[model samples]
Target chain A: MIRFEQVTKRYPGGREGLVDVSMQIGAGELVFVTGHSGAGKSTLLKLIALIERPTRGQVLVEGRNIGRLPRRAIPAHRRQIGMVFQDHKLLPERTVFENVALPLLIAGLRRRDIQRRVRAALDQVGLLDREQARPEMLSTGEQQRVGIARAVVGRPKLLIADEPTGNLDPALSLEIMLLFRRLNEVGVTMLIATHDIGLLDQLSGRRLMLDAGRLAADLGLH
Target chain B: MRIWLARHVQSALASLGRLWRQPLGTLLTVLVIGIALALPATLGVLVRNGEAVAGRWTSVRDFSVYLQPGLPVEQAGELAASLERRPLIAAVRLITADDALAELRTAGGFAGVIDALERNPLPHTLVVRPAADADDAAIAALADELRALPAVELVQLDSDWVARLDAMLAFARRAIWIAAALLVTAVIVIVGNTIRLDIQNQRAEIEVAKLLGATDAFVRRPFLYTGLWYGLAGGGVALLLLLAEQALLAGPAARLAALYGGSFEPLGLSRGGVAAVLGAALAAGLAGAWLAVARHLAAIQPRV
Candidate 1:
């Protein structure tokens, strides 16, 4: 579960990113955050992930106020939630297997467990065949899948993705949405930020739309 | 803890593998470190040999005190006994004029000359052995005091070469220390620059790792290990070079010492010495890598 209680975020130069925004999504729910560019969509996800703090108000995840987490506790707090980026952000020099194994590696899992889990995650993303291939050798969609595998490898309770399909075609975006749907069915909570309105039509899920740093609409579960 | 150990091993091996992947660059960096290290190592051997040689050459820093001519033999004996009682002199032996003449008649090949003399001409002498702690100034002070004694003509010191050898050795020791300090700084700079470049080259990877929930400590592990590898290899190469240089000098050094009717022990690196040199190199590498990683990792925040 994620909660933002009247949170406000302002950038360094006195520009408002998100202002007095409050929202909550319960466990086992997959929500779509839709807004145009500069609509505070990324800021919302960043606040939940504790990548940035709200200049005002509080942000909580799983009942713990992340805004109050100590600096030393940040890494452990981050490990609890999986995050995906639009660019995939996989290390170009590493193989797909190594890229997906980053989270579990950080967790200090045994080699056997890491191998088993990495393979299963790669299989879920249909990237098992390219495990040894460098990320630079993979297609953009495939690279994005590798990023998904990485996010879900730790079996995190919540997944936060920032425009994960930004570079993909409509068909590829649909496939990614379907993958999220499969994950949501398995009870992994997800909050995805995207302006691709077509993605919402395909998935038929709850959508929170932001407009100009405010929560303009909260269309509850359909 | 076991799991932590496993991760450490994995990270260390991964670092070494990365170094292996760029064999040419790593080798060149190691060679630079080794060459820098070799200079000091070779100088260390030289300093040690010089100290040993100086010690041997100065082993007998004695003074031969000649009593005034026509002084009674009993007076010479009394002077030797008095000099021996002084704390500065370890021992003193009186050689009567008759003893010197008898020694010359048999051992000096001067029997024909000795038979022609109506009476003995050599003065009674006292051979003075200074204490182990006596240096040039201390011996000279003692000699000056002895020369002021009644009926004492001359106090000839046999320590000229010893003093000269000590001064030369002292200069060499200072020069070696200065050279060692500079080369060590150069080694650290070389390793630091190499590691800085390595961190810059892996900037993107570091950012990604940080984003994937890696601790700063985790991000730092492999780089530290890479520095360890550099130091280890470089130290090994330096040791080989020193050994080679020592080997080349050992034969000639022993031959020279033999010609001087003395035995010389060539400088062979003791186990402790090897450990010390390698440990210092390892520390330098670790420190240099740590400096680079700490400075750069803080700048590489996760790109939002």
Candidate 2:
């Protein structure tokens, strides 16, 4: 669950990332944030992950205010919310299994448990056969799936993605979206930021539209 | 507790594996540390061996007390007996004038010259050896006490060179300490700089790890272990260098000792000395890595 109340994010310079944006996504909901390049979708997720703090108001997760969370507590907060990136932010030198195991490793899971969970998460992303393959050796679609497996391997309560299918073809994008849909069905809260308008018609979820760092629309679930 | 130990072991081995993968860089860094450590270690060995040799030489130091002319042999013998009774005196042998003249006639090759004199001129003598544990000051004090006796004319100090050698050894010991301090610092800096470069090369991996909820300690574990490996390997190399140096000097040292009519064995580090060298290397490595990690790891965060 995530709640943002009148949150504004201003950068070091005069530019603003988000202005008076407020929204709430209940637990187990699948939500999509859609906007242009500078529309604050990434900023909203950044605030939730505590990568950057909201300049004003409050950002809550599971009814706890994270705006004033201490610096030392940030890692634990980030661990609870799995994050995927457009660039597949996997360590290129490592194999798919190693990349997926990163989150669980941070959690200090036993080697046996880590092996079990990583394999299962890779299976979910249909990357089971590519466990030992390096990121560079995988197709773009496969790499993104590996990234997804990493984000979910720790069994995070909430999962966030920033243009996860941005580099893929439509068919691959649809496949990635269907994979996300399956994950959501398993009761993981999902907040994905994307601007793929064509893909949105084929997938069903609530949409929050941003314009000029402001929340312009909140389309209810279809 | 088991988990903690397992994590530490895993981190240490992983760091070692990384170094093994990049053999050239690791070897170069380790070699520099080894040479730095060996400089001080060699100096330590020299000072220790020098002190041991000085101790042996000083233990045999002796002085001679010359009695006044016309002193009766009975009184000279009584004076020698009294001197020998002192706690600092190791042994005393009285040589009467007749005995001294006879010894000079047999061994000095000056029998004709000495017989040309109308009277035997050699004074009664007390050859005095100080106790083995007596210091230079105590030996000098004893000599002064002997010189103050009414029948004693002069006290000849034969161990002045021994005192000078002890002074030189003391000075060398101090110099070794200063040199060892400077070299230890050099070792620390070498390790720190190497670790800094390593952190720079792994910037991406660090950022990714941090983003994946890795704590600062977790991210720093490998680099700390990297420093540890460098220190341990460097220590090993230093021991080898010390061994090589001892081996190289063994024959020459023995020959020099033979020339002086004494046996010499070039000494290597003692068991404690070995432990000390390795301990210093280990400490330097850990400290260097800790400083680098503290300075650089905090500056890195996952940037959106």
Candidate 3:
């Protein structure tokens, strides 16, 4: 459950990053946010994650206004959401298992429960076999899978991916999208921001398109 | 609760591993802190020994109240008897001028020279031993009171040298404390710098952890513990240095004191004092680590 209500984000250099963007996604829904590079898709996701507050208006998630969350409470808010990046963002020195277990570690979960959840998440992303392998040793697709496993290991209510497949090949991108679709079937709200429109058909659910800092179109869930 | 304990242990061991990975650097830092801690410790031992020596020498302290020339022996006896009646006076022995001259003549090996003198040159004197509780101020005050007597010409206190030594020792103790304070500050800077370098080296990992929702406390735990390790090691080294100094000096000091027919036992640090040193070092290390982390960790943010 994520909602942006007339949110306008202005950068420090007198540039508007997002303008009057208002949208809502129901619970357990998977949506794709498509726009050109720097078209405010990332900004929308950032606002939802509360990493960047709107210059005006409010971004609400799970019925609470995230923009208004106090500074001390930001960690709790962040723990409720899972984020993935295109670069995998894994600690290069850590093993795949350690990277996946990072979220559960931060949550102070029991080692046994963390081990089980981490193995299960790694299994879901088809990375159970490479638990001890470092991210640098893995292929780009495998690295993205590790990132996905990390993002979902904590079972966050809202999952945000910012151009997660931007560095992958077409086939790898499709496979990752299919994995995401499978995750959607098991109930995880997903918001993915990507410029790649070619692989949209395979995971087509809904597409919200942005143009020059404005929500230009909303292709409702089909 | 189990999870919390597990995380604490995990993080602590992880931090220990980090230090173990950089053994040479950590060892160098610890050595620097050890040298710094040892400087003050050495001076502290010096102050203690100085105090012991002063106490030993000052035990024979007394005041010589000399009577005016031509004073009668009966008058001197009366003066000594009155002096012994004072509260500060433990005992007073009266020596008439004639007796003083005769004793000096025997000990000075100048009997023929003293016999040629027309009159005895010495005056009647009262050797006043003070009470055990008489301090430097009290002794000086008693001398002042005695000098005011009609028959008393001069009051010579044998405790002045010891008093000067005591003053110098007290000043030295203060100087040592000042040195200790500066060295403590140096330790803090060393630890703080070490932690700062660590934070800089782990910048990427720190940013990633922040993104993954690691609290400031979690990120800070390892560095704090690492600083404490440095401090504890340094303190242990300082303790060894102090013990080594005492061990090396003990036999020689005893022999030298024996040559002078005095037993000089230089008391080294007590158990509580050693604990205090380690505890202070630990606290200083923790403070330094806290300052460094608080300053540097907040600047690292996950770049979205």
TM per candidate: 0.88, 0.92, 0.88
Candidate 2 on A1-222: residue-level lDDT in tens?
799999999999968999999999999999999999999999999999999999998999999999999999988988898899999898988999999999988888899999999999999998899999999999999999999999999998899999998999999999999999999999999999999989999998999999989999999987
How much is A128 displaced in model 2, in angstroms? 0.8
Rank ordering of all candidates by DockQ, starting from the highest: 2, 1, 3
After superposing candidate 1 on the true structure, give the runs of residues whose Cα lies further than 4 Å from its correct spot: B66-126, B130-142, B149-153, B160-164, B167-175
Report clash pairs, candidate 3. none
| lDDT top scorer | 2
User: What fraction of the native interface does candidate 2 get right in terms of contacts?
Assistant: 0.69
lDDT of candidate 1?
Answer: 0.89
lDDT of all the models against the reference?
A: 0.89, 0.92, 0.88
Better of 2 and 3 by TM-score: 2
- Residue ranges of candidate 3 with Cα displaced over 4 Å: B64-87, B93-126, B133-155
Using TM-score as the measure, which candidate wins?
2
Q: Residue A171's C-alpha lDDT in candidate 1?
A: 95
TM-score of 2: 0.92
Q: What digit string (tens of lDDT, one per residue) describes model 1 on residues A128-205?
A: 999999988888899999999999999999999999999999999999989988988999999999999976787788
